[model samples]
Target chain A: MWRGLQVREQSLLSLLLPGLRSRGPRLQCQAAIRALTGGPGPGPGGLRGELDRFGGITVRLGQLRSADSVDPATFRTWLQGKCEQWRAEGRIAVWLHVPIFQSQFISPAASLGLRFHHAESDASLMTLWLGEGPSRLPGYATHQVGVAGQCPSFAQSNNFFVLFSGLIIQTKNAWKFPGGLSEPGEDIGDTATREVLEETGITSEFQALLSIRQQHGRPDAFGKSDLYIVCRLKPLSFRVSFCPHECLRCEWMALAALATAEEATPITRRVASLLLYGHREGFDKVDLTVRELPALHRGLSYKLYHRDLPELYEKMSAMD
Target chain B: MWRGLQVREQSLLSLLLPGLRSRGPRLQCQAAIRALTGGPGPGPGGLRGELDRFGGITVRLGQLRSADSVDPATFRTWLQGKCEQWRAEGRIAVWLHVPIFQSQFISPAASLGLRFHHAESDASLMTLWLGEGPSRLPGYATHQVGVAGQCPSFAQSNNFFVLFSGLIIQTKNAWKFPGGLSEPGEDIGDTATREVLEETGITSEFQALLSIRQQHGRPDAFGKSDLYIVCRLKPLSFRVSFCPHECLRCEWMALAALATAEEATPITRRVASLLLYGHREGFDKVDLTVRELPALHRGLSYKLYHRDLPELYEKMSAMD
Candidate 1:
C-alpha cells in the first residue's frame, strides 16, 4: 500500500479491498503494527506483524536509505516497535512524540556500502538498503532519533580519553576544543583533531574510529544527519594553551563524570554516548544486527549442538 | 566555428549556423582561438600577437597541479609578457617532446569556479576550452607553461620551479596516497589529505586551497585528477617509517633535485604539480594577480579591487 502510495499517492483503503478478499488475511499484519506502536492504531500493527512473518526485513532498511526502495510491512513494523519502546520508556506516556526519518546520504564518488533509513514514526529499527557501486539505493528521509548506548567502563576505567587541563582555548574564560567550519578538502578526522589541538594546546592521537550518529529535531534545525563517525583520542601532554580567536575554554572531562553547564553548548549528551559506546562496544565491534537470531539457538535441545557449529558465519553471509 | 566544432557529436554546426551568423562575428572568435593555440599553421598568431603587442606570450605548463583556478587576466599585456619570458628561457620548450595531448584533465566543481569543454580538434590547445567566469568575460583553457622565479631566501635558486617530495606516498612495498575510494559524503580534499597520512605516517595542517586543474587527451587512458590544496606539516621524527599494510616507504623530494635512483612513477607527476605550484605561487594566495603584488600589500589590494569582493569571500567561506 505504501509503495503504491509513493507512486500513485492513492488511498490505502482503495488498494486493500481486493487483496483483503483474496490474500487470506492482512488483519494480523495490521494488528502487529499497532501493537508495536499504540497510536494510529490496529491497522498499522497488523501490517507490521504480517511483514515480520514474511521475513522481508532488508526491504524495510532500504526505505530509510533510499526513496526508491519501499517495504510497507517493514516500515510499519519498525515504526510500531519504536512507538512501543518509546511508550514503555515513559517518553511517549508524557507527550507521544514520534521520531522522524533519517539517512546517511553520500557522494557517488565514494565507495559502495549499505544505506539505512529510519521511519519518522519509528526512530529505532532502521530500514536497511544494500547495494553495490554508484547506483543510488533506496532509503527514507526527514529526521531520526539517534540510538546511543551508554556503558559504565567508559567514564573512569582508563586515562586514554583525558588530556592536559591547561591546553584548551578559553572562550568566555573556559577551556575547550576548537572546532569550527571544515576547510575545503578537510576530512572529519582532520576536523576533529585539528579542532581539539587548535582550540586547546595539546597534541593528541586519534586511536579508533567509532560510531556514526544522527541529531534529530534540533530545537533550531529541521533535517537530521545520519550517523557521524566518532573517534577516540588521547592527549599527549598538559599544556596551557589558548587560541583567543576560536574558543574560550577547554578542559578535561572525566569519562565517569561530566560537568554540565551552559558553557559546553555543542558537546552535550553526545559525548556521553561516544564514551560509553566506545568503551563497552569496543569501538570497532558495535553490533548493528537486523533481526533476532533463531529461537532454536536458545530454547531448543538442538541449541547446545548448534553452538559448536563452524558454518554459522558462512551461512549468515550467504543469507538464503 | 570552434563552438560549432565543439558540438561535434551533435550536428550543432548544421543546426546553429544561422543562429551563429545572426549572433556575432564568431569567425573573429574562431580566428582568435586558432592563432592563440598555433592551430592550422597559418593560425596568424592573433592571440600570440596580442601577447607580443602586450609583451606577453602563451606557453604550455604541463601536468602540475591536478586542479587550479585561473584568475581573470588583469594586466593582459603583463600576462603575455610573463609567458614570453618563460618561452625565451627555454622552460616552455619541454612541450615539444611531451606530446601535448597526453595529459590528464580535471573539471572544477561549481564550488571552485571554473569550467572547460573538450575541443573539437585533436590538437592539445584546440582541445582545451577555457573561459572567464562572467558571461562578458571570455576564457580559454590553455596548456600552461610556467616560468620559475628567483627566490633567494629559499634553499635552491633554480628560479624556474621546484616540486615537493612529500606528495608521493610509499608504503607496504607499494605506493598509493592515503587516498582511496571516497566513502559516502566525502570529496576530493577529504580523500587527498586522508590518503596522504594513511600512506605516509605524517599529518599536516591544511593551510590553503590552491587550484583545480585538469590534464587532457591521453592516448592510452582517461584523464585522472589533480587536486591542489596547500598544507603545512611538521616533518617526521624519522624517514624510515612505513605502514606494512599500506606502504613501505614515504619520503619528500624536490623534482629537479631527484636523482636517477629516486625516480617516480607517472602518478607521482600529478603530485609534483601540486608541490611545484604551492612552493612557487603560495597556495593561500592562488590568484596569479595576487601573486604579482608585493607580498605585504596584496591583502589590501585584493580587498579593494575585485568585483563583488564580498560575494567572493562568501564563496570561499562555503568551501571552507
Candidate 2:
C-alpha cells in the first residue's frame, strides 16, 4: 500500500513538472511531492537519516561516507533542500550531529537556521524545529555549577580580617579560595563547606552567598557554560591540613593584602574587594541569602537564593 | 565457568562462617566472596540489577513487580544488603530509578550514601559511587536557565522610569518581566531579548545583567534547579501586541509602583527594587557586565559575567 502511494506521488510530481520550472517553484514542488509521499523520498543529495519517534529526521553527519571530504557548498544546498522536504512531510524536528572535524560546515548550517543544542568533545549537535506550536523539544542543559568557600581566619587584630587561600595545583599554583564542583544533589552551601574541608581541612559554616560569576564555553566543564558561586563561610576550625594532590600551599592572608596580591586570581581579588566593602559597610548590602521553601512536590523542599528582603516586603505573602 | 566460580565463592563463604557470625565480619566475608566470584553473589534480598559498561550496576525500581507496594523499612534493609554485595563486587557506581510513588525510600537510600543524579516526572534517578578515587561518574546538570527582560518603557517621564510588564497567564495573572527559558547554546542576553519579543511583540536589545535568582527543585523544569536572570533591556520598538496565549494583559508601569506592588512575584518585586537602586545610585553598583573572551578551543569565544572592576584592578592581567 505504501509503495502504491509512492507511485501516485511520482505521477503527481510529473503532472506538476511544467509549472515548477523556476528554482523557487521547483523546491515547492518537491515539498508537495514529500507531502503526498508522507515522508522524504530519494533526493538528489546523498545525505541519509532515519525517522525519529516524533516523525522527525536525525542525520549523523560523521557517519556519512563522504562526510569528512564533502564540499561545504554542496552540503549547504543539500541541507536546504532536505529542510524543505522535511517541513513538507510534517516533520517536527531536524537533528544534525556535526563532528568537530566538520566544524567548517557549522556556519552554513547556522545560516540555514540550525542552532547549537549541545556539544561533546568530538561532536556538536544542532537542531531546527519545524512544528506548528513552539518547539516541544527540551534543550540540553548548558551550565555547570562550581562553588567556592571564602573562610575568614580567626586570627584578627586591628581592623583587618584574614581569609584562607590555597595555592591550587591545577592552575600554576595561583592562590584561590578553596573550592570544587558541586556534586549532584549537593546544595551550594553544602558544597562550599565540603570543599573547604577537603582542600584545606578547615571546618566552616555557610554564612551567605556573596557573589556569582558566570562564564560560557569552559573546556574544563566539558564545553558547557559555568556558574561559580562564592559563598562567605564562618570558620569553626583554623588548622590547615591541605590536600597535597590538589594544592601546593594553603594559608591565611590579610584581606586587604590578598585583594591587591598579584598571585590571586582576578575573581578572587574582586571578591576580596567586595568582601572588604561588605565588612566596612553592612553584609546585608551585598549578601544574597538563602531560603528553604516547600516545593510543588509533596514532602520536598527547594532552596531560593536572592538579596535579603527589606522588612516591609518580608511580610508579604510568599510567591509561588 | 561462571557456575564453577559461584560454587567456589559459596565454599569460601562456608569456610568463613565462624568468623562471619559477627555483623561486621559477615559483611567482610560477603565482600570476600564477591571478590573471588568476580561479581555479586546470590544474596538474601530480591533486588536485582544489570551491570553497566563501567562495572557499575543500574536498578529500575519502577520495573519491579512489587515496587509500588514495598514497605520502606523492608526496602531499606534489602537495599543495605544489596549495596554491600555490590560494593564487595567492586562495582564503580550504583544507580536507582526511584518512582515518585516510592519516595518514602528516598530518605533511607540517601542515608545509605546515595545522592540524587537527576529526575523525570515519574521518577528520580539516584546514584552512589563505591569505587576508589572521587566518583568518576559524570553528574547530571541540575539547573535550567531562564532569562527575563526588564524593558525600560518609553513612557518614562520625570525622574521615575517605567518598566514593561505582562500579566502572565501561567502565574495567576501576576505581573512579571517578559521571559522564558534559554534555548540550549543561546547567550543570556539573546534569550532575554528573544523572550521579550516573543511574549510582548516588542523588539529590544540587551543592555546589562541586573540580578539573578537561583532556586532548586522546580517542577516545571523537570524537577531540576533553576537560575533566573533579569537583564536590563533597551527597547527598539515599543508598540505592544501582547501574546494572548501567554499574558492576560501587558502595560508599562511606574518602577516605584511595581517595586512595591503586591501582584508581582517576589523575584519580580526584588529585581524591581534592585533596578530602582541602580537608577537612583549607580548601575555600576548592581550590574554584572558581560565580556566575550577567547575559549580554550580555537575559533570559539565565551561570555563572562561579573561586576565591572574598579580602575585599579581593571588593568590587571586577565585570569584564565
RMSD of each: 29.9, 15.6
lDDT of 2 by residue, B26-141 (tens): 56765766544334543223456778876888887766566546665666666776676667667888888765555456656777777666543334567889999887776655
DockQ for every prediction shown: 0.01, 0.07
Task: For candidate 1, give the docking quality class from DockQ.
Answer: incorrect
Clashes of each: 95, 0
The prediction achieving the highest DockQ against the true structure is 2
Q: Model 2 segments beyond 4 Å from truth?
A: A1-130, A154-173, A260-263, A280-285, A292-302, A308-320, B1-134, B154-173, B260-262, B282-285, B291-302, B307-320
Scored against the true structure, residue B134 in model 2 reaches a CA lDDT of 84
Residue-level lDDT tens digits of model 1 in A1-320: 33332222112223644453344455654443334443233222222212322223212222233433534344434444543333233221111111212111111101121122221112222222222243332222222112111112212225555421212234664323344433323333455567666666666664433233223223312222222233345566545375665654545554323323333322322343334433544433221111112211234110000011113222322221
Q: TM-scores for chain A, candidates in order?
A: 0.31, 0.59
Model 1 misplaced stretches (Cα beyond 4 Å): A1-177, A180-191, A214-228, A255-267, A273-320, B1-320
Per-residue lDDT over B76-176 for candidate 1, one digit per residue giving the tens place of the 0 to 100 score = 23223323333433231111101112212211111122122111112122111122242321112111111111111123225655434443455433332
